[model samples]
Target: MPTITISLVLTFATPPSVGAGGASGTLADKVVARNAHGEFIIPASQVKGKLRHACEQMLRGRVPLCNPPRAEQMCPQIDKDDAGNALPQKDGLPCCVLCQIFGSAGYPSRLRFHDLVVTDADLLPPETLRAMVSLNRRRRVAEAQRLFLIETAPYFNGLQFQNSEAITGQVDQPSHIHIVLAGLQLLFAWGGGTSHGLGWGDVKWEAWLDGQLINKIDSEEVKQICLS
Candidate 1:
């Protein structure tokens, strides 16, 4: 297996409410996800899902891929026996390239994403609370009793993870690494509330393969391959 290390810095241009899964025990209706250390952190799952979505959108018309979130539509589709036992994938059946890299229910992913954390505690801005209300679509008015407070982390220059804490993964083929890089390049906005202009940010990243810096990735070439 070939090893890949990715270092990413995410800088939010506006206050973001990435949500801590749910309310913060009466503190706010929604809060930013954080690690046990109480420092704000973007979960690895979120990052991976976003990247997968970006890649899926890019490859949709160019290649064969299963529409996800629908088990029946996903690749490497499994079968079941009369006894309700899950059957293994047929030997000759192949999964889509995105599934090959991001994995599906029965397949394991080759790439691993790490939580993006604040690069420096001192650089963190103060957290703020904002009151928001839901709108009634029919009447185009604010709905009563729908007012809530959302906790947001102030905008910052960069939040990153590097060195031993960097994102680490293994690839079955060298070209798969380029696919992952191209996906990362496609990611711009992140987290929740993007439709309302929250969680808007940019990502700057560097990757290394087997301790050797990867200076460039020809995303155009990867697109061409997908088209073929």
Candidate 2:
């Protein structure tokens, strides 16, 4: 049940004006919108679609890399409208949709909704596992919806319980933080997963995670129906 809050910081607001000879603008001004410690939402329909498609790709034994490859691993072409100037997405397509469940329709590129001030939704991963597990259970979606309301909650998944693992520049912890270090190293490293891999590590990790999901859902009738 490894989970992280995934406090995304992607901005989607408009960029700033250019100075003399296309110099530059402040990074913040250039950014359209960004949230470092905030939560965003995606339409239920979208999440369901993305998850199922990606999961199926994973099940098919291929890593599901998002289109465009670099920007977003899920949504594609988030630039502009048919006439330019960011198009109003259907219920905020590119941005995650969970944030609007609490009333964020008017907060462009903002979604602090689904308040977790007194809940465990954070720790439990915003019902991903559960949502994926219970689409068409033993009863109507209406019934399942109610039960979900009862069970849905916010939780702190961060490692706050343990003494914060401070790196003293040694052991398992490195002294310096390298940006995209993990991503770059694993981008094409042909190695097995954590279990063991000389040059097969990256692919092995992908394959292992892919195998785990289906195995986890082995007892899920809802998953079977949904994915079917």
Candidate 3:
């Protein structure tokens, strides 16, 4: 089994709105995900979602479950129609690579991520209050008067996990873990406002096997396997 430790220096490029579902305070619209510890944290679920999407992009049609004959119905690539019914794939299968590793409807993901916790609370960026408005299509001007505050960590350090269970699964496969780490670099944003370009981070990955460090992301082997 390999224990993967990722050190991330996340520099928020834009305001992120992970959304606590509702808003409060004088500004009253700001929402973000926070931990019971009262610190902003990125959940493991979020990381998993990002990794899955990144894998899809990097692997393209290579994932068995994502490819035709198997993905037609089960793949996330398939979208719902106007009536809200899901369209079928031309050829679908029981599972894709994502399903195999991360699990799907019937399976459980082999990969696990520990929630990313902020290292220094004081280092977190101060919350920013901004005026919210919608664009008017007719006049192309800002409309509607809404105020919200967004708590964002413009710069901070955090820790996350990528554990590879040795006995229960096949971590011995070279392509399996290598491909996964590569997918991390492909992740662009976390939380919300991603479409508007926010939450980008520089992540450095390291791997340990049996209590001994085995790989650093910058290593030549990793460069060839992951970066290339």
lDDT of each: 0.72, 0.22, 0.51
Please give the TM-score that candidate 2 achieves against the real structure.
0.17
Q: On residues 50-70, what C-alpha lDDT tens digit does candidate 2 reach at each position?
A: 323333333231221223223
Instruction: List candidate 2 stretches off by more than 4 Å.
Output: 1-56, 59-68, 72-91, 95-228
Q: How does each model score on TM-score?
A: 0.82, 0.17, 0.64
The TM-score obtained by model 1 is 0.82
Stretches off by above 4 angstroms in model 3 are 1-15, 23-30, 67-72, 75-93, 145-149, 153-172, 209-228
Task: Compare the candidates by lDDT and give the number of the best one.
Answer: 1
Candidate maximizing TM-score: 1
Enumerate clash totals for all models, in the order shown.
Answer: 0, 29, 7
Lowest lDDT 10-residue stretch of candidate 2: 159-168
